[model samples]
Target chain A: MFMAPPATDIAPRDPLLPRIVRLRGKRREIRGVWSLEVVAEEGEPLDFAPGQFSMLTAFGVGEVPVSVSGRTRDGIGLVYTIRAVGAVTAALCGLRTGAPLGLRGPFGAGWPLEEAAAREVTVIAGGLGLAPLRPAIEAVLAAGGRLVLLYGARGPSEILYPADLARWQSARRAQVEVTVDHAGPEWHGHVGVVTRLVPRARFDPDTALALVCGPEIMMRFAVSSLREAGLSDARIFLSMERNMKCAVGFCGHCQFGPHFVCRDGPVLGYDRLAPLLRIEEL
Target chain B: MEIHDLEEVLRGHPFFEGLEPQLARLVRGCARLQRFDPGQRLFREGEPAEHFYVLRRGRVALELSVPGHETLVFQTVDAGEIVGIAALVPPYRSLYDARAVARTVVIAIEARCIRDKCETDPRLGYELMKRLVPVLFQRLRATRLQLLDVYGAPGD
Candidate 1:
């Protein structure tokens, strides 16, 4: 029989355990950041909505919260288009194919995928924000809803996940518009913030749900733009970002007013967060 | 810069005052910069007490979980404050998780390093103890306020 270790001997090990299995993907260059389509190493199906996120940990370094980008049959794939900011992210940037990393949770509340099951859906992703909204778009298409995706980036160089986006657009025959802040020599698309594309799309917001994610500045503009486009606060949803350590509610790090972003959000309707959303600093 | 630069940033902090310059520098050396966006966690309950942190900017909320009930938010740590010092003492492990409520910056110092340095130099350790006691008292007071928030009658 194997002997058990003493309680004191195992003291102080990291408390968090990886709930979602992480799989390695062949890194592909997408705009300025590297894109990795991470699938579940364990084959557990990820049933998440548009704006839910997972906490990806590079052991011995740290963990970060990322949006789930794609939901496929083999396993749920996460498209990580990360900016090399901190120690953990910097270390993640150096990882190559077949490199192992830890995955924990499809944590936080996702877009109301279940609630919006039958409604028309509009998803707006600005810059790297596309990483999280990808799953929502996929879910809409799978559910056979009329879905439109509006993607905006700083320029041609910052667009993320070309192959996946192209496949979804062509296969589903969904409307996907690509906009840029500045166009390069080879670029031929609308040039402006993502909000500019709102006018071109046709979605009856009163009966539709609009999900938006991007930089805080962009999200603010997007929300207001949707409202201006006659979308009610309750009909529009926005994904909020903050540094989340524990994807669980146990950590108070991701609190906005009385809500925990890691638990209550990553996705919140404009009606719920509208008051705090106006508070510029928070 | 030396420890005084750290002290200036943490001016009015009770945990480092009256320390000898040399010893103060040793404590400061262990600290590093940390930053967080709105709605991020610094640590969680039941996690190892690895490092104690001092807030430089932003807000941190401390939350405690109670069985069969909603988790209670105990307190908020604002800018220019020190937290997680108790984790530096014996039986180190966080009692509650510390999290950032807004875009926050902090200085985190490894408690083990400070503990080792304190063991090697008792005199400096004594100064640290004196400075740290009042902070502990303040935490206790804040925790009491939280208890009232949790248990007191809604209108009371």
Candidate 2:
């Protein structure tokens, strides 16, 4: 789903302070996972890049980094898909419609959508990693370009965004292949790591951009698989997650080697991260 | 199916992508089409795995039955993939019960026929082993990944 373009542009607010928002909608995606839609309490729309994240606060429970899953044209509403594994996220997931919460940022760099218009795009996501990549996937689809999606989950029930995946598969330009790590007799889909599907996806490695996000270990394997499939390190992008606070470079809490994940990335190129990714405990 | 058609199917299958025509013909007599209804067992654990199957259509779940708990499906093999690879090695007994999760079709190749052909022509034996080795390695790698529980494991 998409919204209209911004009608009136407002001045950017302080990056540190949180703006209050009201929960407009919520849907349970799976056990312990929720897709939340919120509009600023003052009616200011959230204009964020597809892969950028917001610092969501549950009042007293504290703030956590939640990526923007969807947004409307005028920014009147913002969507986030969150899994309640921690205190803050658990609190956010428990809220009912009209509940008030705090939001900060549309922070961090986003996927390279502008440069990807002419290239074939292949997106590889595992489990909740799809949430951050959802916006970029929608943007690529909206541009009317072809996309190949290879997704892996723990099992059938752990799959996120089933309806959206079906809709994208129905589109002529998108090819979706999903696999699970394991399943019972009831499941007929492919069973294996998401990386196994890389060789099966149809795309020219010479002119393709690969977007990947998921558990750290899964991302590492995906990089290897994409490389084996003939993609260069420069052609791959990943969303790197780390402990983030302050949402700006000043805090240094989200430090990843020399870079700050909050400001320098959450989205980074594999070319630059190759050496770092090889370093243990970096 | 006629010998001509069966050989044609083997030739066209991805598994035989680059096998020599003569080499493919050597094992053609040992091949036949088989189907299993949904929920039917293709092979049971501890049984002699006399034939390895190349799935032409449908899905098969390789499972282990444990007392007092639900069956554990460690892997699900899809169309175009091979199953029952144990037939190629010593103590050729199935390690799991391969059950058809849906109506399925496979090209069953008798292990004895393949082994005999290999003995007669060293090249044919080497070529078949070359292909089967990779499938075995891939399955091993997949099982290792499954044990990691990458999706549900605790980590961002």
- Per-residue error (Å), model 1, residue B144: 47
Summarize candidate 2's per-residue lDDT along B1-156 as a digit string, tens digits. Answer: 898898888878777777888988987878999999999999999999999898899889888898987776777787878898888788999999999988999999998888788899999888888888887776676677777887773453
Please state what fraction of the native interface contacts candidate 2 reproduces: 0.62
Question: Per-residue alpha-carbon lDDT of model 2 for A1-282, expressed as tens digits?
Answer: 899888877776899999999999899998888989989877866688988999999999999998898874456798999988888988999999999999899899989999777778999999999999988999898898789999999989999999989999898988899998877767778777887788779999999999999998889888988998999999999999998899888988889888999998999999989989888898
| 10 residues in a row with least lDDT, candidate 1 chain B | B145-154
Q: Model 1, which residues run further than 4 Å from truth?
A: A1-15, A19-23, A37-50, A76-79, A171-173, B1-156
Pairs in steric clash, model 1: A243-B40, A253-B39, A253-B40, A253-B41, A254-B39
* lDDT of each residue in A1-282, candidate 1, tens digit only: 999876684454243686444546645465225655566665545555557777777768988887776654365466666666568876776677666777767677888887666888888888778878877777788888878788876556667777767876785537787766543323334444566577657788788888888776667767866887899988888889876888788878888888888888888888999899768777
What's model 1's lDDT at B108?
A: 83
The reply for model 2, stretches above 4 Å from the true place, is A1-12, A72-75, B153-156
Worst 10 residues of 2 chain A by lDDT: A67-76
